[model samples]
Target: MFGVGMSTAYARKLRWCTLNARFKDSAIVARPGAIRAGDRETFMKIVRFILALAVGIVIFSLTVAAVGAIGHGFYPPPAEFQQIGDRMSDAMRAQDQAAFERTQVELAEAMAAYLPTAPTGSFIFVVAAWITGAFVGGGVAAFVTSWGRRSVAMLVGVADVGAIILVSSLLPGPGWMPFVGIAGSLIAAFAAGTLVASGTRTKPSLSRKAAP
Candidate 1:
């Protein structure tokens, strides 16, 4: 009887051990699955952010262009040569040198007809709009792609700066002012890209395991 009892106890212990082994195996399997799931969630979040940022940047660029176009009306033809030539012809035909000189002065004044002392304000608005838009776009792109945010941001910034400079050149102003605005816009875009790339939120990891 004692031998039989000992055998029964050994059998119970073995069953318990088997159950514990199975539990541990299940726990181990669950842990990796949980980790993988967490990683996937994080990747998805990053992707969404990048997409949002790209859209925002595009919107901002368009806004800047629209504002500039609205502020300055349609781009005028080269007034210095064409309009002046017309005026000179008219003056010469009328036999009036004084009138021709007057026409030149009038043409100069017309070309300088932009609002005075407010160019700085306009520049600020343009730069702000562009930077804000670019930042948002870059952030979204970075969030979407785990890599390449920096390159994207830099590219966008350079393009925007170049565009702003070109537009500024077309405006009626002292030649130096548009160049300055372009420089400022470039600086602002770089800063904005950096900010957006860094702003993407990383996902947290999750895991699970069976208790020992």
Candidate 2:
């Protein structure tokens, strides 16, 4: 009888030990899956952010081009400058580096002479285009991102500022032009981000309050 009792206790203890081991093994198996899931979520978020930035940049470029085209239509460049542009295009097509460089120098000289004499309206128009583009692009970026909307908007602003500086360097503009562009883009982006965030917050709260 004592031997039987001892055997029964040993069996029960073995079963308990086996169950405990299985529980620990299951927990160990679950940890990696949870970690992988979190990593995947983070990676997807990054992809979404990149896509949003690309879309925003395209929109910004298009807006700037459209507005600048309209400005050009209203305030046409001199015929001499147009001729220079034609030559520049021909030089590019012919792959004549010397001709291209000569045309660029001619264009720069002509612009330097003409811009100071150009109407104040033209300068204002250019600044307006940059501001409009920044506002629209930043707002769109904020709207597109699922998270980090403000950061995305700010990124758009920074991109615009960089582009403004680059273009100003390449093509001569008034010394104050870049500063204005930088300030306008930053303000527009901030306004866009704030507006979008407020709109998003209001919608959700309204819906929740309305829910019975």
Candidate 3:
């Protein structure tokens, strides 16, 4: 009888161990699935942000192109500058590095001379085009992303300012141009972000009584 009782206890203990092992195995499997689901969600958010940024950039480029075309039409470069530009293009097409470099130097010299003497209208147009692009592009980005998210829009604005700075540096524009571009782009970005953030707020109904 004692031997039989000992055998029964051992069997119960074994059964309990088996059940516990199964529970732990199920928990381990469930945890990995949860982690994978979370990771997928995070990845999707990242993808959405990237797509938004790309769209914003494309829009910004289009805006800049349209405004720049108008500016160019209004303030055509000097004949000499145009001639040098044509030469530069030809050199590039022909893959003539030496000629390209020489033409580039000539173009730089002409631009430096002309920019100093250029009318204020030209600079105004350049700055205006960039500022407008930044505002519109940043706003669009903010609209596409969540109302609470502004990083994408702010990045678009940063791109605008960076592009302007790069162009100015390469073409050697007025010393103040970079600073102005930075300031304008920053303000535009902030305005876009503020607009989006405000959109998320609920307006109180007129019928609601004032709090005591």
Candidate 4:
């Protein structure tokens, strides 16, 4: 009877041991899944943060451009055309070919003087406006679609080139300044898009099956 009792106790102990082992296995399996879920949530938060930063930069740029435009309109540049027209009027009135030729030289000088003087505050504002406008415009364009993004880049390039051409016609200087703005905008938009896309791709899919 003692031997039988000992056997029964051993059987009970074995059954308890089996249950405990099963419980430990279940806990171990559940831990990794919980950790993975936490990691995915953390990654998503990081992605959101990055998107917010990009959007903020774009908005800041637009604000700067708008302010610059308002200031420029209020304080217009020197009127080169009015002086030139006055000279031409005098030349026509005098009806002296020699005097008109001399007046033409003087008018040219006056026009040159009207051309943007270096170290002007307006120059700084213009630069800021171009840079900020490009960045904001490009970012908005990028958000539309992939094709729209590329189109934005191209459009910016063309617009900058056009501005440079237009400015060059009025004033003499290097025409490459606007190109720099275009390139900068394109690069910024590309970087923003790539970062956002990569972040999206790296995000874990919650619907995936957990490991056994």
Identify the candidate with maximal lDDT.
2
Model 3, 29-97: lDDT tens digits are 999999999999888877777887888878878887888779989998799987998998999899999
**The best candidate in terms of TM-score:** 2
Q: How accurate locally, in lDDT, is each candidate?
A: 0.61, 0.87, 0.82, 0.58
Q: Candidate 2's residue-wise lDDT over 31-141, tens digit each?
A: 999999999999999998888888887888888888888888888778999999999999999999999999999999999889888877777778878888888888888
RMSD of each: 12.9, 2.7, 6.2, 15.9
For candidate 4, which ten residues in a row score worst on lDDT? 144-153
Q: After superposition, how far is residue 154 of candidate 2 from its true place, in Å?
A: 1.2
- Clash count for each candidate, listed in order shown: 11, 0, 0, 0
Please provide TM-scores, in order, for all candidate models, with all chains considered together. 0.44, 0.85, 0.74, 0.39
Per-residue alpha-carbon lDDT of model 4 for 1-212, expressed as tens digits?
A: 99999999999999999999999999999999999999998887656544544554455456556967775676565566566667778878988688778777876677577544534555555655655555554455445432334444345434544554565566563345455545654565455455444444455553343434
Global Cα lDDT for candidate 3: 0.82
Q: Candidate 1, residue 61: CA error in Å?
A: 1.9
RMSD after Cα superposition, model 2: 2.7
Sorted by lDDT (best first), the order is 2, 3, 1, 4
Which candidate do you rate higher for TM-score, 1 or 4?
Answer: 1
lDDT string for model 1 (153-193, tens) is 55556666666667565545455555655565456556655
Considering lDDT, which of the candidate structures 1 and 2 is the better prediction for this target? 2
